[model samples]
Target: MNKKVLERHEVPVADTWDLESIFSNDEQWEQVAQQFKERVSEIDEFRGRLDESSNILFRALSKQLELEEQLGKLFTYAHMRHDQDTGNSYYAALQDQAYGLMSILEQKTAFVTPELLAMDPKVLDALVNEKDELQAFAHMFDQLKKQRDHVLSEKEEELLARAKEALLASSQAFGALNNADLEFPTIKGEDGKEVQITHGRFVSLLQSKNREVRKAAFEAVYATYESYKNTFAATLSGQVKGDIFQAQSRKYNSAREAALSETHIPLSVYDQLVETVDEHLPLLHRYVRLRKKCLEVDELHMYDLYTPIVKDVDFSVTYEEAKQKVIEAVGPLGEEYVNRLKKGFDDRWVDVQENKGKRSGAYSSGAYGTKPFILMNWQDDVDNLFTLAHEFGHSLHSDYTRSSQPYVYGDYTIFVAEVASTLNEALLHHHFIETLDDKEKKLYILNYFLEGFRGTVFRQTMFAEFEQLIHAKVEAGGSLTADELTREYYDLNVKYYGEDMVIDKEIGYEWARIPHFYYNFYVFQYATGYSAAAALSKQILEEGQPAVDRFLSFLKTGSSEYPIDMLKKAGVDMTTAEPIKQAMQLFEQTLDQMEELLEN
Candidate 1:
């Protein structure tokens, strides 16, 4: 690790984020908090009157959703602020307080959806008929009805809901330990310096040119996590048990069903992703072997994974240069997109510097009534520049969706959220390849593409698979003890890596480290989303406007329709295995090119 206490970036406390735009001061927020409590208590007034008449029911439901919208804006602002600065006790208290109130408010309106669905079928139809706004929520309403079938009596529902507050302890503990508590060993860098091992910096360090440094950092990291595996596993087992308990309690057929029911996605989509990826593992294996060949190593250990075949990305990009590079790279997106994206970046919509207590990782987050905002610790490098473009893809998608869709449907699901960001990355990668005349630079870009596919598609899929396996095991009346989860996780890593590479037993302890598994089948969507973006990137490159129109429609789409149906409008039918297969083919082609170039 090369570090002399890296100068961490500062969070923009100055004209940085207009959180005050949501609420100017603490007094205003307190007033809103009291109003939430008051309005939440008023839901009982509409108890049985939901079926009385369409107008009354519509007014009642709209009021409930309106309350939610206001609450969402308030909570979103508070949480985003707190997420950026976890150490800020004031914002943290506000977040915890807001979250508690939201929970209470959720309980107050708990009966609304179930009660509405439990009504005579004619009432729901009539309500849908009278108002288009109600029609817009038909899918959401119907989902509630679906839940009604599985729901126990109101008392039973309340009991399960209350139990959930306790069931969440393990995952919460994991988050605290991983992000805020755990520390790692320091490696003496080639430059005679030591760096603090961070979750964010670890990946870049593993890509270090020095094998000893990479090995030292990699071994040191797992060593730290390994010593604590038992605790992690216990927490992990609790997480799996929690998933199983909820799935069974809710009458879901299985853990997968419970997880996918949110998106109403077909089980085949999950099955197909696994199947397609399994069929294509050999390509990954070949890439692995070729990487070993390129490095001329006797054995490729886990530590060797990040030692780049192409040693360094020598090109340095300043903030301004990065902006221009991203702009030129995405030119195939057309002049309109180019102009709007440039304006958005330049207009202070991005918090473009890293600072103390600032959040790690990048995201585009804003409510319905604001310019889509992005936050980044924008280092002067090619990576941060592309990170900027990638997040802008998310911001622009939010901008379009918020402007076009109503509050009820403004937010898209996680399944499609990565499509825009990953597509931006793919386009930028291609743009970099085309613009560079140096072969080594071209090789560097190719290595980046390979690493990305592996990280986003291959590694995430492995995570998704392990998540499902453990959840299924628990749901099947089996206990996923710490030992069992570690064993299962290790087996999957060995299988995926094949006999060619060493799978350190310590890596099996990974199930304890990943937070995404607790998200309940959420990780698979990232793998699928990247595949979809790769497919779309090919479209935009080959058939400009028609493809652009399809993709823009996807960007504008929110939750108005099911994820699968909305994706169909964008020209890729995700329910089938086509997109995954197409992406696998691209991965193979990239590997083939990788080998030929390396040998040259």
Candidate 2:
């Protein structure tokens, strides 16, 4: 394998995303940035007059959203540029400038929500009833009204809005340290050649057939983090404190409440995810035991977890093959979906390779008016193929929503964000199962599916629990010192993985590296969303067109309805534990299939 890191400019032009669609050039972006800053203050002119007439209120709302949409495009362009090459000073400055513009815009528009909340309920309702354009924002109005207690006075709101950039500093610092600054030591690859560890390549290293290489990669990565544990802890603690402060300032009982309340999700969903997944810990333990037996190892460590238990079954897929497989995987979603998916591939909506200082992991991102472009550190493997399908799920969801809904509902809350992505993964898994005939190859695919369950469902739930524990600790006046954080994280691993696996001490330092910790109660949705998608995917597979239609409708609905209600309309009620339990049942059946294959 070529271990050379390509400079951003050296990466193939076709492999890169089309950010030029957002802004033709940096100079154009600059001119628009300047014009946007000047016009942002125009929001101030309509502020005090929101309650005067329905027409006045409509204009205020329209102007704020218009400016926000423009700001989204600017910030999206700048951030994607920065992400493609974090070491680039120009893009970094552009990102910072975009953030500054956002803060200013936030301050200017801060009065709209407060002023609307200040008006009499009857008056607000009557105004909405009066204007057809205003009716499009009925959902927004309802959300604002629900958050009445949390909406501070206009001046206070503006103060918090002004602090947005500052509150984000710790997260930004962590990103800089993790993505751009810290360097991992060279480790021997499976072939005994030295390769530098990178965020993009770390997991693939762990999946090596060579145990010693996996162990070295795992320990080397953690040890590097261990040296910087104190710095990570401080940044994480600062972020937690920031989250708590924002939550408390907004009259929330806890940071989780503040985060969840945005989508009107009941806390029970989180609690039940943890509780239900805990109940299913025995299944994870059983899977771990199966993994140990399959690998014929005396002791299974965390590093051993990623290697395929079924030996010598090649599942590597090229980027082109992945594109074809992904397009085929979603064939159940109908021709239009397939055609659009093909278009995304053809249009260069995905940035498909790891380059020097590029952001790690995969994400689907774009502004309301733009194609939902994807960022991926492409590797030739099934995991990357699955990731391709997963990200395309998000992109297609964005495509459908943007095409179907108005700007007000063009995007979705994060709660439902993973559903479309994970559902695509499920369909891809199903496609593999139906097509593959060889026992060993089928075992490889099954191993991949089970590992997906382990990672997405069990692993993320563990993250959710850890996130909850740390936030609660800070809320209880506890400090998240390095030792304290590491201890709690290690303990959670022990509880989640059970006695069948050795919980490595180096794994405790794992918390220091997770970027999601900075996202304030965001990781739990992966677990919940995966569960919801499992149920929804099963429906689409079994019930045919009606289920497909319901699922497609859910995608296009966007944020027009509450997330829970949207899922309910799509035929799954996340408020209940049934979806999660249903997902676990699927996990058990898949495990059963794997065990049967091994026995044969």
Tens digits of per-residue lDDT for model 1, 1-600:
124333333344542655676788877887998888877777778876887777777778877878878888777777767756555678767877777776776667666666776777876887789877677778777667766667666566666666765676787677657755676767677576876666656666677778888888777888888888788877887877887778888888887888788778878888888888888888778878877887788898887786568755575567778878878877887787788788776665676665445556677887777667787765555567778888988887887788788888888988888888889999999887777788888887787788778878888888888888877777667776667777888899888888888887777776766778777788999899998899889989999899999888877778887888888888788988889988988888887776777778
Q: What would the TM-scores of all predictions be?
A: 0.92, 0.99
- CA displacement after TM-score superposition, residue 261 of candidate 2 (Å): 0.3
What tens digits encode model 2's per-residue C-alpha lDDT throughout 358-419? 99999999989987999999988889999999999999999999999989889999999999
Residue 491 lDDT, candidate 1, scale 0-100: 91
lDDT of 1 at 257: 86
Clashing pairs in 1: 9-354, 9-355, 9-356, 10-354, 10-355, 10-356
**lDDT of each model, Cα atoms only?**
0.77, 0.94
Residue 202 in candidate 2 has what lDDT?
92
Off by over 4 Å in 2: none
Please identify model 1 stretches exceeding 4 Å from their true place: 1-17, 25-27, 145-148, 160-164, 316-319, 347-359, 370-383
TM-score of model 1 vs. true structure: 0.92
* Candidate of highest TM-score: 2
